[model samples]
Target chain A: MHGYTANKDDILKRLRRIEGQVRGLQRLVDEDTYCIDVLTQVSATTKALQSFGLTMLEDHLYSCVADAIAEGGDGARDKVQEASQAIARMVRT
Target chain B: MHGYTANKDDILKRLRRIEGQVRGLQRLVDEDTYCIDVLTQVSATTKALQSFGLTMLEDHLYSCVADAIAEGGDGARDKVQEASQAIARMVRT
Candidate 1:
């Protein structure tokens, strides 16, 4: 089992906000809002999404990765390796 | 000012462990260690670092971005915009 479990409701709530922000940006584009204004809203939405991603990743590390490392088994070893490669991919982008 | 600020020491501590893990992988490669074992370590390190990135990103959202959105000013707006672009760029990769 993946050790990290996200509260579905909270995830939805954050995501909903981001969605709204994105829609607002779309509206701004439709209405010909100032470039700076649209960009600002875009920034807010992106940061929010990134924040959500961060929380999930953090939980995975503390709950899953750390636990796997402590247990010291083949399964644990495999999980740790999987996590490392996944992160390297994340950073490389 | 960027609303999110990192605890430098903690970041360094996490990074140091990652550094050690990477070095281990290097050794494994040179010595022609088991591929599976090396890949496993790589996965763990990647996840750990990704977790760190997530924490920083999350903090930036709750601490800085949220505050900026609430305040409602030119500066706040600009910051929000900056965050959005950064995040979008992040997702694209």
Candidate 2:
């Protein structure tokens, strides 16, 4: 099981909603919606995607990262480093 | 015609690609992919959405906003303020 295994359905639901948001964006463009309106929708979609990422990060930290650290080994250090890099990518994006 | 009218096709294409990215994320989660790997994909998808928003904002500034400012009246001020608010929403998200 992965770090998010316990809440797999919830995660999938969030992703599905985000997928719908992307589809909505296409529909807006298809209808020649105003630029500012379309941009506003885009911002909303981006925020949803970012929120999903944050939830996943939190789950990972609470489960896999915590487990590794509790065991006290090189794996724990590596996991923390890897997680930090992932956070950096999210922030930069 | 809106600011993005000239490149409507391109915008739609980008949104389609982003939709695919979101679907891929679902597949990864379905397969119980590692948390870090999933988070990385999430970041990539978020960046793509943000980039799409920026492109729309640029087009708006070039066309609609520019036209208002050239007219030089209350409309110009209103357009600038509206655009500024849109930018704030994007950044805050």
Candidate 3:
């Protein structure tokens, strides 16, 4: 099974909520809501995405990375590198 | 200025569209859309996020990484690592 298969439903639900938040954000922009207010929504949305990304990362580590490491050798190295790169990306975000 | 600041508006626009797509996916689930159909929408949403991620990565590379490299030494090394990790994460996704 895919790494995210276990939490697929939860992930979708969260993304759905984030989707609503994004729509609200668009409405804020459309109505010319306060600059700071819009920014606040943007911040929230960004955080939501970050949170979702982290959860996905956790799933990947536990499932895919764990599987790769079990296989050993190049598989292990690749998985570690993959995890490291993911961390790096997340930090930048 | 932040790396993404240059393309902030465009990025926002793209995110807004993706946000709508996410909502549509939610609707698909809520209305009991077909399983494969919902899965298809899910795939699209994932791709949208990935595309957004890549664009953000590009912006980071051009601005933040460029700045770090210009600074030289540790800064460059850190930035290179940062970029590599990001690419790894993207590939996994």
Ranking by lDDT: 2, 3, 1
Which candidate leads the pack in TM-score?
Answer: 2
Give Cα distance to truth, residue A8, candidate 1, Å: 2.3
TM-scores of all candidate predictions against the true structure: 0.45, 0.98, 0.55
Model 2, span A47-71: residue lDDT tens: 8988899999999999999999999
Candidate 2: interface RMSD equals 0.8
Off by over 4 Å in 2: none
Clashes of 3: 1
TM-score of chain B of 1: 0.73
| Candidate-wise lDDT, in order | 0.54, 0.93, 0.66
Model 3 per-residue lDDT tens digits across residues A23-90 = 78667655545333444455556567666766666767887788889999898998788678667656
Poorest stretch of ten by lDDT in candidate 3 chain B: B34-43
DockQ order, best first, reads: 2, 3, 1
As for DockQ, the candidate ahead, 2 or 3, is: 2
True-structure Cα RMSD, model 2: 0.8
- Runs with alpha carbons beyond 4 Å of true place in candidate 1: A1-6, B1-93
Question: What's model 2's overall lDDT?
Answer: 0.93
Q: What is the TM-score of chain A alone in each candidate?
A: 0.76, 0.97, 0.94
Report the lDDT tens digits of candidate 2 across residue range B1-93: 988988989989999999999999999999999999999999889889988999899999999999999999899999999999999998897
lDDT of 3 by residue, B20-47 (tens): 8877766755554533344445445555
